[model samples]
Target: MIIAIVGATGTGKSDLSVSLARRWGERGLRCEVVNADAMQLYRGMTIGTAKLSIAQRQGVPHHLVDVLDVVDEASVARFQADARAAIDGIIERGAVPMLVGGSGLYLAAVLTDFRFPGTDPELRAHWEAELQRLGPADLHAVLADRDPAAAAAIGPHNGRRIVRALEVGDLTGEPFSAGLAARETPWRPYRQFSLELDRPRLVARLDERVRGMWRDGLLDEVRALLPLGLERGVTASRAIGYAQAIAQLRGELDESEAIAQTQALTRRYARRQVSWFRRDPSIEAMDAAADDLAAQVDRRVAAELVDTMGG
Candidate 1:
């Protein structure tokens, strides 16, 4: 059985996961945390991403956090593949895999056994060249013409998806959306849960968290990472805190304005998370702010594990 704790940034997902993992360990049930947040994957992004420290991990092993260089791109498809392998390893060791973090798409990809279209190296190279000259909007327009359904499904601002769709279409001689639709589930069935909080309370918590991040040198962390020279919209630079901090560093905004903007963005992101997770019926949603959250999750997981053992 897998317990996935998911919510927007600063929603106590990590804290809850850590507490649960430690609790399970005391119960002689081995447990490990597998990161599902995209931003937390990068090295040197600790404070901004609220990555768990070794001490905070409380000797419970964690997977996929701080495992990538800032320059490397960690895709949702890559995360799904790696996380599945990690889950299998944990289960083999008689351990429960606890999927944790706020990256809804990443969690969905793993939990639903969603398969992504395969990339063509040659086609990717060609598109890379074209992207330099044609720009993202042009590429997105091309995708819109070829696969309007896919274009509508993907965020217009998401250049990576737009480029991948066009590349897949060019390589396979079929619509990119068609390729995605043809993909198959790549994982065995697993039980999952989603941690939720009241919208107003979540937003208020996000505001406080963002303020704390600024006070705790989130700006400095971003500044330290700027020398890595990652381009805008690249995986690392596009992270929520990094993007807003870069604006301040670039003289586009002052410190106060940057903090305010970052807080607003975080609140908006939390809202989007609520919307996304609400659509998935498979997610056993529970109010994470409740005092008895761990007990509730334990009961849910214990019941499911009993059924799995019986089967």
Candidate 2:
């Protein structure tokens, strides 16, 4: 079965994935990870993203990580296709596929009956140009009029998403949120878990993690990626710590300001993730701070597998 380990950032999702894979291996059931984190899909975005190195992964095979260039736009539709293919391939090899990440939307794309509408390049370009001309707030006002639900959900600050919402609405002549509607039925046989942590504790952990990213030389990583078109990258350049690092590199923000801003944004993003996943009733919640999280999740998976077999 497809197993999803999801939560907000700094919730130890990656560590749990590796731990489960190792434990499953000990029991002679092969398990591999398929990354559902959007930023982790890009190569060379390691330190800021908290991506585990090859050594840290402890030889557990991972797919869909480091498969994209920084310059490439990260499309949810494209990722949905790639991630499903990877999961099917792993299942074909008689291994369990673990979908691991805090990216709630990405996880939903795989785990739910999510569908994507066809895109019209001309409509997309029109919305993108409108976003560039009018800015996110003004463009979002336009979306609010066209599809109030989408506008409320997307908010005024996210220009890229605003553009997509408008594009989808104009293209399909329906509310953008309608395109995101998913049935309760999953696309695959899956067991899902969402790690839960109290906001104060999670905020503290996320702030420290942001500081750790800077301590680990996020600026240096951004510098290394700049030559590889990181600055020109539509998606990569806007990543939380990476964006702050770029601002620091350009002398627009001091080191302290950059780090502080990144910490704040990371916490905000984490809240959004929690809200997104909280809407899904199928994901079982597990305390992220629990000492026996991995073992607990493993037992749940084992029970599910047995139940599947008995049926």
Top TM-score prediction, candidate number: 2
lDDT of 1: 0.77
Estimate, for each residue in 1-311, the C-alpha lDDT of model 1 and write its tens digit. 67788866776888888888877678677788999998888888987788889999989899998878888888888998898899889888877888998777788777665667678888888877777778777877777888986775554556776778788787778786663342244355665667777778878878888888889998888877777764443788777777878888889989888888888877777776777666556667777778967777887677666455343
- Full-model lDDT for every candidate: 0.77, 0.88
**Number of the predicted model whose lDDT against the real structure is largest:** 2
Query: Using alpha carbons, what is the TM-score of model 2?
Result: 0.95
> Number of clashes in every candidate structure?
0, 0
lDDT for 294 in candidate 1 is 75
Candidate 2: list runs displaced more than 4 Å.
152-155, 306-311
Instruction: Name the runs in model 1 displaced over 4 angstroms.
Output: 120-154, 169-186, 230-233, 306-311
Worst 10 residues of 1 by lDDT: 179-188
